[model samples]
Target chain A: MKKLINDVDAILGESLAGFARAHGDLVSLSQAPLFVRRRAVTPAGQVALISGGGSGHEPLHAGFVGRGMLHAACPGQVFTSPTPDQMLAAAEAVDSGAGVLFIVKNYEGDVMNFEMAAEMAPCATARVLTNDDVAVENSSYTTGRRGVAGTVVVEKMLGAAAETGMDLATLQALGERVNGATRSMGCALTSCTVPAAGGPTFEIGEAEMEMGVGIHGEPGRRRVALASASAIVEEMMGAILADLGAAKGEDVLLLVNGFGATPLMELYLVYDEAARRVEAAGLTVARSLVGNWCTSLDMAGCSLTVTRLDAETTGLWDAPVHTPALRWGC
Target chain B: MSNTLVLRLIEGMAGTIESHADQLTRLDQAIGDGDHGINMARGFKELAAQKAAIAALPLGEALKKAGMTLVMKVGGASGPLYGTLFIDMGKATPEAAPTLADLSVMLDAGIRGVKARGKAEVGMKTMLDVLCPVADTLRSLVDQNETDGLDERIIAAAGHALHRTTDMVAKRGRASFLGERSKGHLDPGACSSALLIGAVVGVLAPSSAR
Candidate 1:
């Protein structure tokens, strides 16, 4: 209940405004709180990449908006899906005659709203659904695996592919390739509080942890007695790797993502162990991203996303990118 | 239902959702992410804002506009689901004032819309648990020529169905995440739908009508 904010009602708007002010050089907020896009729209021939979900997963759909990433991001309230209108508006603003690609996470509301938007939008629109979380399939709020940190990977790969002047169909196909190759699993030390709700979404005992946790505090596979950080990472990696089936000597993209409240100190600890395990499994870690790329608002946990990489995907991951969160070879 | 009756029912439903906002949030907190009440209140507030504009319109157009308003403003699972209800009902409704049989057809269309949008059926601990039964009761009453106290019967059936959600397992939405843990808590969507049906019955079935 005690965090930095002026009021509960203004949290999303004020925070977005502050983000716009701080990163005005990189991106601009729309007249409404629904979306944020690059300060300058994408180049004329590049396909537009749009992704969105409920707010609270910061630096996600928004921070990724820039030269080689997302063209636009539609954010909803904390953990609530954005309306179709917002997605439509974002689509209209960013579609550059190359058609638009919606990189939707596989939540029921997110899917439904995005689908509605796609149907209503006048331009040619296609969707690439990311459902890389290896947690319980068909868990609450979705028909299949939930989209977790794999979204960050999908966005980056597709964003780079778009910047390469790929057509909407090609970008959409590349997006599906990345999503299909990725798998993520998370474990939570504590639950998160949605600002409007004024309390934690769920309760966990002091000596217990949630396994295979979804970002929105959805029930994981099971709860067990708390264990050491290394032990937890091993278990999480085991689940992800078992599902991934990466071949020996394969190059892969790895993401050690924080679920909002988890700090870098622990994320590094996770990355250290994750890198070692990937290497131990005879797979080469081609590229790595470590930070809170996707989150669930003040929840204490981290998720591990592993994408078995092909030569094209690996090269795209290294593509020059200029965004607030991920800026490098630009 | 007459256009005036439809307008009055919408107003009453808005008022009821506003008043019970906190209760809905509390119910959601137990199993879901705890924003059902907030989203519903925001959506109904928008619907209420359209009262003057929709009051004079035909029933189908007015209800359709109401659905669009909720879809644009609510921005959550409930927005599209409830919006589908009104929109489908509007499409199914005749241009003229609807008789009880016509209302039954409208409700049938609305419930089907919910099923299509949410992919949920009755006994899945969703709004359909209450809405489907009400639709059935309306059709049965019409078939039997038992129109006396029809609104009362609809409300009572809806209430009973709403209560039944407490014993059922959630198979949709955020509550479904809880699995067995979702049991014993009343589904918030069902609660809101029941309140909406009750408000309509309150307007359409005064004691004199009974």
Candidate 2:
């Protein structure tokens, strides 16, 4: 229940205002219908990339809005999807005649709202749906896998491709290709509280953990007795590798992402274990990232993502990029 | 019906959602993320604030305005799904007072819009679980020319439909992530839908029935 905020209603606006001010040089904020756009819009011939979801997963959609990444980001209420109008406004602001591409997570609300935005958009539009979370079983009887930390990978690689003046269709295709090669799984040591809800989304005992948890604190595979970091990484990596069907000598990018409350010390420990596991499984770790790139709100946990990589994708991953939350070789 | 009735329905639904917000959040906490109540309440409160302005318009326009409010304010799966319901209903309804048959048509249109938007259907442990049955009851009542106690029948049908969600496995939304765990709990979206229907019908029903 304790949070550093003026009011529950003002949380998103106030936080966004601070973000816009702190990164004013890199991005601009629009409040009438809230969205963040790059201060420097993509060149007229380059396709614009937009992605969004509920708030509380800070430094995500919004932080990624800058050069060589998302052209804009539409943030919603805490853990709630942004409205279609936000998406449309972002599209209008950032679309440079090369059309717009929506990088959507595979959540129900995110999917539906983005779909509506696409249908109502004025310019040519396409979508790249990321469902890289291997925690849930994908079936006609379910909503399929969620898009979690692996979304960062899709956005970064596609952002580079877009920067290279890739056509809308090719960027969209590359997005899908990258997403299909990524797999992620997470376990939560505790639950997160949505500000308006005024309480934790779920309760976990001190000695227990929720395996395969989603970014929103949605129930994962199951609750089980807490285990060591090595054991946890093994279980999560097993699910991810089995689902990804990664083969020997294949190059991969390993990401160890922390939930909001998790510290870097622990995240790096996870990276250490995850990296060793990948090497033991005969996959070459060509690139690596470790941080809180995507997160649940102050939840104590982390997720591991492995992206099967090739020459083209690796080159894109290495491309110079500058964003508030992610920057390399810029 | 009349613009007055539309205003009353909006106000009543908003009040009901506010009162039941805690219950809805608790239900969602069990199988989904625990924000359904807060999200629905925020949207309805905004709609209620504009009820007068919205109700000043013609019947169809009023409903459409109300639906747009939900779409803009409520930022979850429910917002667009429920917004589509009201918007499509508004699209189908005429400016003139709608007959029972006309109401049935409007409900069906709304239901179809929800189905298409969510890519969902009845028996999926969603709001459609309650909404579809209520739509069917309205259609049947229109066919039978049974106007007496119409609101009572609709409320009863919605209650029954909402109850059925407790045993039905979810196939959409965050609840679907739970798989089998999603069963054995009421769908929060269905609960809110039934509550709104009850509140609206309770006020809109003829005074004589009460």
Candidate 3:
């Protein structure tokens, strides 16, 4: 609550404004909030790439809105999907002559809103929802589980394709390809606070932890009164590995993301264990990225995303991409 | 009945939730992931901002917006349920100015929406169990001119329902995961929601009583 703000009520709006202000060098958009873009957007020719969702998952949907990434990202309220109206605005703002490719993560609202946006987008919409990303289950309480950590990778890969002048149709297929290849599962040790609440979003006892936790802290698949760091990583990795049907000699890219509150030490520890397990499974770790790449506001947890790499994921991974969160070889 | 009264009711509820969220979270910690207090407070804070959205909107629309806002602004299980309830409430009243009786109707609609979405029911130790009785009793009392303006009786009823929650076994929700261990702790959903109702009632009471 006290970190940085003039008004708690205006935090989301203000943050959006601030994001546009600070990152103006790399990103820009129309007067409307939904209209978003990379600074050097081509208003003609290339198929525009667009992605958006709730605001809290920073560097996602927005921070990824620069070169080789999203053409526009409609930032919604935290953990909520952008409205159809916003999506339409973003679609219009970022539409290049060819069309627009929407890289949607598979959360209920995201799916529904994107569907509406596609029906209404100025450019013909090419939609790809990240269902293969999360290894969680839908619950009676939730419309569906959620699209979590893997979205970052999906957007990155697809955005790179769009930048390479891939047609909207091809970009959409590539986006699907990325989603299909990625498998992720998260675990939470503690909860993070919503800035307005000034308290934790959820609580986990000193000894308890939730497994397969959704990005929004949706009641995870299960919980255990915590175990060693290795054990936690083992469980999460096992889920991702099994979901991918990853077998011996498979090559994969590993991403170990901290859930905000966790420090680098723990993130690396989890990554270390993940590496060991992947190697033990006879899988080759092509590349690895670890740290708080995606977060839930200081929620003391981590997630593991294993992309069973094929030629496409590897090519996109090596693409000259520059986003706020992932910048290298550009 | 008046906007000022309604504002005060909201204020009271906000205060109680702000002050006592930890208690609710503690309850959740036992059976759930411990977000009851945090989720409700976040939902209400967003609720406060929607006064503008709700101002010209019909009661049902206002309720729906509040619910949708909760779902969008808040995360976790309660977010969508509470968010959907308000949305359904708004859909129910559409263009009508909901009276106190309509408020009961709204709550009933909300309960139904939550149940339909969550598959939760009374005595399952979810919010619906406590809310069902409260909303029904309030509507029944509307004819009796008994339940209005956040009175002590309503507060007591909510509290009674909340306390009674401890006696019921959790048939669903995260608490069900705990099985027998869930009996002793309060139903986090009911407790926090009652605190909301009770807080409003506290505000509506006579200043002299305070």
Candidate 4:
């Protein structure tokens, strides 16, 4: 409640206006709580990518909107899924004709809401790829992975794939592959406030941190008094890598993501530990990204994701060109 | 059976949740990150603020308003689940806010909505585990002359079903992933449902005195 705003209800619209003001060259806000590619999308031969979720994970689903990334991004409220109307608008605004693909996180609300919207939206052909790489505790059987930090990487690679002129079907298949090959694990030292909730989403003792925590402040599988950055990274890496089953000699892409409110220095320190653990396990850490690539509001914590690399995937990983959030090989 | 009584039940339920938000949040903080209390509290506060309109409005509209409010305002599992619950009740309120029979059918629809939304069923350590059973119990109580001890029956049933939560393994909710560790803890969802229903029953209790 201590934040600056003209009206609490119009905050989303006002903030979006501010973003459009700053990033006018790259993107602009649409009528809906959506951000579309400033460039016209030609869907005839090109595969258009779209992804959306709640708004709090900033510089996310939206910031990645650009030439090489998502053609449209629909943002719901903080940690809430967009309604069908929003998604329908995004699909239409971005669809140039060839086809559109939706990269959705595996949370139930996101999946259900997206499914509803897709059912209503008319497009060439759309594929929905759900990301659930939590690596927390197994769900019923093998369906247990919860989508976490891996979404940022999957979007990057798939964005690059689309940039390379991969057809919708091809991009869809590649997205599915990336979704399968990734896993993420998170730990939290404190809970984040959901802005509207007006307070910390949850609380943790100063001496303790929860392990296996999900983004929504849902309980993690385990908790213990806070430990060293090295130990925390080791445990997170251990959980993620164990679930991944990547062999010691295998090469992998690693991302150490800050939940939010964590500073760059702290992230680099954690990354230092994570990189060491990856090498110590005899696996080749081919490439590593350390930053607030994905977050859970201003929650003080971090998560780690690993993407098993193959020649094809590594190429896409390298192919990412430009986005407000991630920019590299152009 | 009266619409007057039914409206009172909802108001009482909403009040109960408003009162117990802190306890609920504290419980959630244990197995999951907290927020149940704050979310539900905010949800009910919205309901209370529009108390006159909500009580006077057709049951479905009121419930739908409640559900939509939660959907927009609350986040995480509780919002969706409670929102779904109210949505279902609203959808069931074809004629007016639910009467006794309508309440029964409304709750069953709510169960279905939650099951569909959460992909979670009765065994999940969610509110449905309690709400579903209580709905069933209430249906059976509609007949029979008692009406006097009905509150006790509702409370007893909710309490009894809640205790069973200890034995069943959680299949959904955050704790469901914990597998066995979830066994000992009373499902927070179930406990909250009991509190809400207990409030409804309590408000109706003094009615017999009146």
Best by lDDT: 2
The sequence of per-residue lDDT tens digits that candidate 1 reaches over residues A1-330 is 988999998999999999889999999898564699898866788789999999999888899999899999998988889998888889888888999999999887898788778878988999999999888764343367788999999999899899889998988888998999999999999998888778877789999999999998888899999999889989999888999988899999889999988889999989999999999999999889899989889999999999999889988999999998889897
Query: Using TM-score as the measure, what is the rank order of every candidate, best first?
Result: 1, 2, 4, 3
RMSD in Å for candidate 2, one decimal?
Answer: 1.9
iRMS of candidate 4, Å:
4.1
Tens-place lDDT per residue, model 4, A190-270, is 888776667776668999998888777666767798999988988888877777888779889989888887898999998
1 versus 3: better TM-score goes to: 1
Of the pair 1 and 2, which is ahead by lDDT?
A: 2
The model with the greatest DockQ is 2
Per-residue CA lDDT of model 3 for A88-131, tens digit only, reads 77777777778877777766456655665675566788888776
Instruction: Report how far off residue A18 is in candidate 3 (Å).
Output: 3.7
lDDT of 1 by residue, B128-195 (tens): 99999889999999999999878778878987899999999888887776778899999999999998
User: How do the predictions measure up, each by TM-score?
Assistant: 0.96, 0.95, 0.64, 0.75
Q: What do the candidate models score in CA lDDT, each in turn?
A: 0.88, 0.91, 0.72, 0.75
RMSD to the true structure for each prediction, in A, is 2.0, 1.9, 6.8, 5.2
Taking the tens digit of each residue's C-alpha lDDT, what string does model 2 give over A143-178? 888999999999999999999999999999999999
Candidate 1 A-chain TM-score: 0.97
Q: What is the lDDT of residue A328 in candidate 4?
A: 85
| Residue A230 local lDDT, model 3 | 88
Give the range of the ten consecutive residues with the poorest summed lDDT in model 1 chain B: B201-210
